[model samples]
Target: MGIDTFKEKCGYEIDEMWLPRVTAITSILNKPNLYRYFADSPNYPAAQRRLDSAAEWGTLTHEVVERMLKGEIVKPDAKIIPSIKAFQKWRENNIMRISDPEKDVERLVVDTKHMFAGTLDVVAEVNGTRGVIDLKTSTGIWEEHYLQTAAYLSAYNKTARLKEKCTTRWILRIDQYEECLGCKAKRRGKEGVLRVTGGKRICNHQWSEKKGVVEFKELEGYKEDIKAFLAAKELWEWYNKKFIRRIPNYAKN
Candidate 1:
């Protein structure tokens, strides 16, 4: 489903251009849960709390980093200090210059060609290359994330109305690292030593400010995936109409 927003001051609504978000179509929640190797011992309440923490950490980290990229120094909150520190450490080692960011490319102008819309996180030059950059805080870079980036790249290229085509798009991960107690027997000992892992980290969540740890990757197969994303959108539309969200007046106008 797509989210609808109206600007009170503008007086005119931008609704006809409404389309499902590139993110919703490529939603991580829709993916098949890959079974964790050593996570069969599930703590339901603890798991829920950790999930909540991850989501919170991700949002706070995004706010802090966005300000930092604009050359603003923000005092990190206790919750997201590790994540901000991790990104800062990476920037120190890497070359980055923010040209522009927080771009919204979801316009109705292309709804006829592409039936999707999305907001971009950033557009900047990193290590000499300039392209759209998306901040991700998920467990690991999933396939859906790749497609989501590709979709945003397509939308940005069109919305910006640039002469030269924008070729590259990136997904920058700003996630916290935590100690994993799952694989204690083999690596650590019978005494159970904790391993620093990205996804399985449970208690005392800390971001490792290791070089290249919190990093960016070119969105590979971006062009090819746009075709896949369009197909998925068509299917999503068909499903929604056939089962739910079929009311005409209540639907997006």
Candidate 2:
């Protein structure tokens, strides 16, 4: 969505007053790659070319599985052909089972009065209990990543009458990468562990495959983050109304 549209929906003043922080905050929630895949139309030809180049796409999946089982960080690479292939496989296996094929299904009604509206990726029964599933592409799983999934759960909870026993939500992580010859040398050195050294810890996290994708469990920090965002949204709405009142009516002249 455009800045103006987002501003109006979230009830925030979009001028120089609150633009920078709002933009940054939104950027965190709206990752560029995620938006491109979900919000934009797929570039079929380009996607096909990448898939063609990764002849050993299955190898990458095996590597991701091995790394998770061994608790090792899968190094990041510019080429993400394997990750795309993995997601394609995941969609073929799980989308229909977890997602309501009927777009008209009454999932939830987000109150856009003080918040922005968004759609849940999957809103169907998971093991006889209703839950949500959000997909992600990453080199490896991490604890902080769970926050995004939790945010989705909070958003869904706000507007939908979720099943009483259905408190479970999940982040489906697909690690897309090609095996590099250099990894052998790096793994032999201390720098290998230092390479994926951001966030709170230096270890690679693992996720268990629930359906077709690696399921990331939600954390308490994510719940607090969502609460803070909703509170800020309310304050932003109030500021916008107050600012509009201060604008002088020059049309009478």
Candidate 3:
């Protein structure tokens, strides 16, 4: 989304007031890796296009997986079939259950005291541990992802009943890539852009079958993460104070 659109959608309407979004708040932090990515790119416009396309692709994948989790049979796009298959395999292999599909899947949560809101991916139990499961289609999980999930978990627990409170948070990354047979370099082809990572620069370059990778990682230290998130929220508000001031229903606190 563009800057203006993002600013407008940074919050959710509640009782005629707008509460800031968790993701939007966390987005204020600096990312050195992202800066390097842009610096290494041939040009800013091309890099932006690739990033936009990848975001769309990721959203499509999220929608398909969410629908499937809701017990709706879904045929994912041909490009994302591998990732979906990996997710299905993981689901079958693990003792995981979506507590309440209707309410737990893409659950909308709000922290009234903090005045923030977000739609979390899943409220689930994996291997007997109940927690928030955040789905990601990024190449790698970053610290900001932990902050995002931490914010969701905190907000969710605030309003949840005793038994419904989450004990922890997790990031479930679903991605597909092809590895070179000779050099073992992995190539990710998302949104029609092929990017290679690791291995020798010059090689015979025989690529293996495209395979999906699912990584489930538990994020710790929610106490600190949420603190960081709130700090970021403060910074975000300061950066957008002018625009935010124009929002009629926005709660500046």
Top TM-score prediction, candidate number: 3
Best by lDDT: 3
TM-scores for the candidates: 0.69, 0.43, 0.93
lDDT of 3 at 192: 58
Candidate 3, 1-253: lDDT as tens digits: 4546855678787878888888888878777667755765689987787777788889988999999999999988898999999999988889988878999999999887777899999999899999999999988889899889988988899899998888999999999999999899999887457888888998988888899989999998999998888888889889888777777888765
lDDT of 2 by residue, 32-87 (tens): 44333333225765444443433244345445443432334566242444454455
User: Candidate 1, overall lDDT?
Assistant: 0.57
Candidate 3 colliding pairs? none
Error of 1 at 64 (Å): 0.9
Candidate 3 residues lying further than 4 Å off, grouped into runs, are 1-7
- In model 1, residue pairs whose N, Cα or C atoms come closer than 3 Å (at least 3 residues apart or on different chains), thus clashing, are none
Error of 2 at 35 (Å): 19
Candidate 2: C-alpha lDDT: 0.41
Q: Which ten residues in a row have the lowest lDDT in candidate 2?
A: 185-194
TM-score of 1: 0.69
lDDT tens digits, residues 108-220, model 1? Answer: 22333464566667766678776777887654677777777777677667755564336788888865544334432111111122224334334444433322237677877
Assess each prediction's global lDDT (C-alpha) against the native. Answer: 0.57, 0.41, 0.87
Candidate 3 to truth, TM? 0.93
